[model samples]
Target: MVASIHPSLFDRMVKLRRDLHRHPELSREEHRTTDRLVSELERLGLECQRPLDTGLVAEIPGASDAPTVAIRADIDALPIHEETGLPYASDVPGVMHACGHDAHAAMLVGAAELLMSRPEPPPAPIRLIFQPAEELGIGARSMIEAGVLDGVGAIFGGHVDRHYPTGTVVAVSGPVNASTDGFRISISGQQGHAARPHETVDAVVAGSLIVMAVQTIVSREIDPTHPSVVSIGRFEAGTASNVIAGTAVLSGTIRAQEPAVRAHLHRSISRICESVGQLHEADIQLEIEEGTPPLVNQGPMVEVARRAASEALGPERVRTMVRGANMGGEDFSWYLQEVPGCYVRLGARLADSAGYPAHSSRFQIDEAVLPAGAAWLAEVAVQGGRELATGMVDDLEAAGRAS
Candidate 1:
């Protein structure tokens, strides 16, 4: 099933995304981006609110006072230099929509246009949320604090993944994305000359041992079939080659599909750091910063998204992802925690390039997927709202009869 939105509206969506790409903003600094979105959403005659300085919400009322269903698009860009070299490439230095948020924002606006164009308004309320700071992983939380999900029964979101073929859409039923947690380890040892290394406990050596042991948490401690990753991305120690540094810092991230696995990994990481320091007779300090939890798609919500996908794109284009829960985290998980929702991956693989992952300077998306993404979201909101309202009415009536 292909989307039946007007061609002119589709063209407008493409142009809007391109314009956003050229003038990308970063994280909480999305003033101009929010301005453009507010203008478009207001033009569609929806009620708009800019609760966060950079994020905004727009509502489209339906036929009744049914619960709201929210559809979100992250508006923030990344601090990456553009190498795609397109004419509409980012004009701002060190700022670009390398993660396809430009596309997400524009598509949601397109969805707003389509939903408003209906001859008769939707059956239940719909909210279009333009969130900022997704790159920093705080936008969704900020919006939630601002009550974007108030009175809403369900939510829907998507990310552009270049790994999938253009026009392909994927949404998994269980844990579709991993929980992201970060840790920092500091080891303090006696400073001494490199020539007399035996005199110093060698904090660098201790930190290295901790990093190596942390890897065993995923390989041995966790089930082999369960998805998990412990990567030591940063290690810093001596300033000069001749002297052993007094302290070393090691920082990395933990990713896992299950909450139990995440907890186990964190516990093991702490144990490894402390054990390594004891063995080397060095003082150790561990700091772990908790991040978003794994996004587990509610079974019913995934079914709704799957149906919407088949309706907006052809059934053949709607794929069920069986493997590869993205280790990257999304704050959208915050919304899912409050209500049932589904987050999908909209394929943005360019026609010419093989496969370039997001956050890379060369990241690009196939422009053709814009309408499909937008239409799918708008349709899902309308349909999902109706389902939720019907369920609520049925339960209320049952209660009244029992009374």
Candidate 2:
């Protein structure tokens, strides 16, 4: 299936990917990245529109005015120094395309090129969304606000996963990613000398207890079958070794695959803090910042995506997430809330070295995945568009029969 892509187009996509890698930009600051994409997309005769300050929305008109099937790719970099010694490494200091957004954008551009280069127009309209600020988990929402999904029937998107070997596409039909929420806990206690511990409340001890208590929320309270996480990534307290810390701060992320579980995790955290504070006779406060929702791919959308994957790559190459749902957060889930969409994981694992995780300084992907990923995107958009058109026709026929 990969051999179907022209060698020249593949080379161009590789060049574009490396160029993006060399000059990576952070979220909402993808001006140069956006410019590069516009240049490439416009070169294919696709009319592009800037719906936001740093992202683009372009369309390839179809044979009819059917609702557009949107294909999205995030174009944001991370705050990590490049560790890979490749010649095309990031030139910017303390910034890199650690999460493969460069590849995503390039593949999406390749998909656009392929779609436009076809001899005949697509069966239905296609919308290409080059989005920004996905790392901050708000880009999709902003694009929706800008009317990107106004007439869109279904959307398709994917990420480059280093865990799977290149050529495999995970197009499963259930929960793929979890909701990400952040929390901060503040505990206030009376300050005193370490020798006179009886006279004052120890915030460090209370904070420690709270941390250990929250860990039990998933293990004891929630069902073992359900996937959830409450982790305290940061804890701060105590200015001096001998001084009893009067105040402490703890912050971390909360992830859940179900709404009931998400709410339960939040409630449990608050309950633990309050109970621990009362036990220690200290004041405790907790603040929760809600983030992206759990990304559950609709069954019908997954079927469309799976068929597309099978067509783009062989059926043997189409796979599902071996390990249950991913606990990481994805803002693409925001789009699923408004309309049906499927977000798959494109295998981009490098065969040479044991791959590093996304957001790592040494993260990398197999360039071969670019063409295959682009092909999958193109196929999915066409199939999704056709599905929507067929369903619309069926609905009309049913109405006519009733009348």
Candidate 3:
């Protein structure tokens, strides 16, 4: 079932991906990228709408009222400067396709072309979402707010991973990514000369203590069975070497796989900071900003993905996760909260030792997987449509029997 993409389509995908890579744009600033996508989609005979300033959504028509499934590809680049040195390296200064989003967008375009190339329209309707600002973890939510998923029944999104070899897919059914939240601690005290330490509340000492104590939230407060992370990324205090600092600010992120664990970490963080502040006699204020929830793949959608993957690339290449975990955050979870969906991790890793992870300046993808990814998404839509259609039949039969 899973064969290579047509030669002409594959050639177009490579060229488009390289062109996008060379002209990388930052989050919320993808005007050029969006225009490129609109042009390509329109050339394929599909009408696209630009609801936001930077992203676009195009629907592939199918039978009337057929179940709708969507395939999303983020179209944003990171702030990292290019270091890959490839001919297609980013031309934009301080911005590069470090996260494989260029490939994501191109593969989605390839998927659209593949579907259109078919002799008949899809069994189900399909929506292609080219979203921006994904690096900031707000694109998915913002797109949803703009009504991208209005009539959508199921959705699927994927990230290119360097961990596994090309032609591999991770179709896990449980929580694969963590929920991310952030915390800020502000401490106030009296300023005084360094020689007179006793005159100041010593905010630096208090903030330092808070940072060290916050570390214990994951190790001591939470259950050891669950995975979590709490790391202080920034700390600012004091203005001079000779003066005692009167104020300090600390900022960091929080991650967890379980809701209880996420809540527990938040509670523990506040308690620890407050306790340290009281113990030091410094006024402390804690602020928590929650981010996206965990990417928990629905069982049925996972089944759809797995079945489609097997049909597209063979069962041996489809890997279903069991007990492993990742602490990274993905905005795709926002869509899952509103609809049943699956988040897939396609293997784009190459054999080179210089291989770097996503968001790294040296990160690169094996271009060969572009067609595979496109084919996989199309198969999922077809299989998902058939599955839903079958379930609908079963429901009607059961209702008839009851009557």
* Candidate 1 clashing pairs, residues 3+ apart or interchain: none
**lDDT by residue for model 3 (173-268), tens:** 778899999889999988999999998899899998988888787888788888999999999999999999999999999999888889999899
Please report, in order, the local distance difference test score of every candidate based on alpha carbons: 0.87, 0.93, 0.87
| Model 2 Cα lDDT, one tens digit per residue, 323-363 | 79889999999889988889999988897644578888998
Error in Å for residue 5 of model 1: 2.2
Estimate, for each residue in 322-354, the C-alpha lDDT of model 1 and write its tens digit: 457888888898899899989999877776764
Q: What is the C-alpha RMSD of each candidate to the true structure, in Å?
A: 1.7, 1.5, 1.9
Q: How many backbone clashes does candidate 2 have?
A: 0
| Stretches of model 3 off by over 4 angstroms after superposition | 321-323, 395-403
When 1 and 2 are scored with lDDT, the better candidate is 2
Deviation (Å) of 124 in candidate 1: 1.6
Off by over 4 Å in 2: 1-3
Error of 2 at 135 (Å): 1.1
**Global lDDT of model 3:** 0.87
